[model samples]
Target: MAKLFYVLGASGAGKDSIMNMVREQLRDPLMVAHRYITRPVSSGNENHIELSEQEFDFRINRGLFAMHWQANGYRYGISNEVCDWLAQGLDVMVNGSRAYLPTAKARFGDQLQVVWIFVTPEILQQRLQCRGRESAQEIAQRLERAIAYDSVRPADAIVIDNSGSLQSSTEQFLTQMENTVQGQKIKVAMDSPC
Candidate 1:
């Protein structure tokens, strides 16, 4: 049996950056599950299967997704096709939603390994602004949403702080993935002080 590594974070928490690095370093025997999103595919980011709202809902109604949720005015989904890969004993990772943890956990059980990537509010604001995808008010709203989602972070998650250098955070994320793939206890110093 393989683990389902669920990567969770705030809107600007750099989940994609870490994941992209992980992909470059770890090729075979690991998979990063791409999402089916209602958002138009952005340049130089995760390649998602983009669909219109109507098409997304049609697929959902057809039971094509293993898990799905709406956030920030977009619908995201992981296709049921991944279940076939899981059964092949391949470790799979997903850029996941915090709101959908309970549902994902129920599906994967002990195979679910939560990796929570976090950043300070100041860093998050700066990153969000740099992305040029949102206005000041929209950025504020995303930060507020982050505060609410933080409370839902799983107790046993391997936490990583992505507030500083991307290289450092990506290395930490790689170690986490390596351990998971080898069935070793994930070793990492907690990013949080509390």
Candidate 2:
């Protein structure tokens, strides 16, 4: 059985970078579900789809997105390719919202492994500043929501503190992922119909 590891974190917790790094290091088959978004392509990031608000709305009506959300006045979503990879027994890495975990778990069953990446508020603020895409007001709002998320429970999750360097955090992520994959296999087996 394969695992669908859904990585969740605050907006600036380095979830995207860590996922990319882990993918490069993984010897196993791994698929990254590219998120569809309405924001312009940020400099140095070229992998995402830059959809217009109208196009995003059309797709949402068409049920094209597996999961979608509106944040910072932009829309974002995960495509059905995520499930496609898991169906083929390949590991999947996705940067998703903790708010979406229940829906994913209900849909994917035990195959969903939610990993929450953690970072200090100070680090997150610095990253957001370095990105230079959001305004000070917007950054403050996002940080508030991030703090709120910290108080909520992420269902069936592994929390990885990422305040350190990327290398150290990647090592911790891989270590936790190894354990998560093994546990996911048991879940798949149990859920399999006799």
Candidate 3:
């Protein structure tokens, strides 16, 4: 069966950069799911579909989203199209929310694989400062939150330390995916009847 690789991390953990690199280099059946968000496209580096608050409500009422959550004063959603992809036996990856992991895991069950991308606090602090998007106080708060989140990360999550070069992080992510695919193939082969 296909799996959903749920990628999540704190701000400045390089999730976007590493995922973008993986998207460019991956040659497998895994498809990355784009999120629909209430935030404007220009506000961040993520390539999400922007939706008005009213539009988001309409979709929610229509059951168009497979999963949805609110964070940082905005709503984010993953379309039901991801379900279609999984049904078609294509593995899917979604940039996910740390707070929404429980709901996602409940929905996807055994098919969900959590991938936590992280960096050392020192590196994360430097990255946040360099981004210049937050005030000093806000950055400090973020760093504290990141540390707290790291402490309670899911026990089964595949953790990637992304404090070094992007290339190294990308390679680690790719290796994880390759291993998962291979393991699935092995299980399928073993389950088939002679």
TM-score of each: 0.89, 0.89, 0.93
Q: Report, for every candidate in turn, its global Cα lDDT versus the true structure.
A: 0.83, 0.80, 0.87
The Cα RMSD in angstroms, rounded to one decimal, for candidate 3 relative to the true structure is 3.6
Q: lDDT for model 3, please.
A: 0.87
lDDT of 3 by residue, 73-133 (tens): 7999999988888887788889998989889988887678899999999999999999888
Error of 1 at 108 (Å): 1.2
What would you estimate as the lDDT of candidate 1? 0.83
Worst 10 residues of 3 by lDDT: 185-194
Ranking by lDDT: 3, 1, 2
Model 3 TM-score is 0.93
Residue 68 alpha-carbon offset, candidate 3, angstroms: 0.8
Q: Look at candidate 1 and give me any clashing residue pairs.
A: none
CA deviation > 4 Å runs, candidate 2: 43-46, 187-194
Which candidate leads the pack in lDDT?
3
lDDT of 2 by residue, 1-194 (tens): 77778888988888988888998998777888888888888643537888998999998899888778876677888887776666667888887776776777777766777888989999999998998877899899888988998887565678888899999999998988988786665653533210
Best-fitting candidate, scored by TM-score: 3
Model 2 residue 72 lDDT score: 61
